[model samples]
Target: MFKNIAKDEMNLQDKPMSRFVNFNEWIFEIKTIRAIRVSDYGQPYSAMANINIHGESAFVDSLMTKSEQEFARIDAKVISEFLRQLGIEQVQFERFKNNQPRLHSVSLASEPHKEHKAKLVSVG
Candidate 1:
């Protein structure tokens, strides 16, 4: 929620490297959840409880633990909301030739979610 907004604001600041690193950590945490679910399912369920930080000197590692399908769904929703807040009207995802998901388009304007004649753009 506001955490992503704060991260976005940080990205707009002068120290963008650190902010970008943080943002990438967030993305990795999110995408990893999906990958883990897609990998296995018959393991013990776990969750991301409150991250308790002791002080500024505390060791903070960006490690993604095993997550359940429900956690992955929540992360997906959070990412979608964050993208919406960033003025992205639509995000088109397509499967590659190997059936892997990839980001196809990020449209600022809303487009019909269907196969249209004008949508065909030669990549070559």
Candidate 2:
């Protein structure tokens, strides 16, 4: 739920890097959001990817953990929601979710997910 803001209103450091990917006929915007979490002490950030489909958005794969080995995971259900929002039929969505290679086979518990790792960031 972000409104278009003038470039001057955006903080250089606080601004996220956005990328657009075309899926079918819809364009999905993916952006990385960095933030600090206040826990018992201040907790460092976990990389967050915000996905927006036709203005409907969801925050998927935001994981905060002490273990560096623990990776952020994207569940099919989350992706399915986006597809559903795009007016994908139930059968097609199910087929895409089920038949898609490497979708269900990858296990987070066994090994680290082999995807692009987010750049390490620090907030002063």
Using TM-score as the measure, the top candidate is 1
CA-RMSD of model 1:
17.3
Off by over 4 Å in 2: 1-42, 55-67, 74-124
Clashes of 2: 0
Q: Stretches of candidate 1 above 4 Å error? A: 1-71, 93-124
Count of backbone collisions in candidate 1 = 0
lDDT of 2 at 120: 32
lDDT per residue for candidate 2 within 67-104, as digits (tens), equals: 55333233233333333333222311111224452212
Error in Å for residue 16 of model 2: 27
Q: Can you list the residue pairs that collide in candidate 2?
A: none
- TM-score for model 2? 0.19
Supply candidate 1's per-residue lDDT for 56. Answer: 12
lDDT of each: 0.30, 0.32
* Superposition error at 46 for model 2 (Å): 2.2
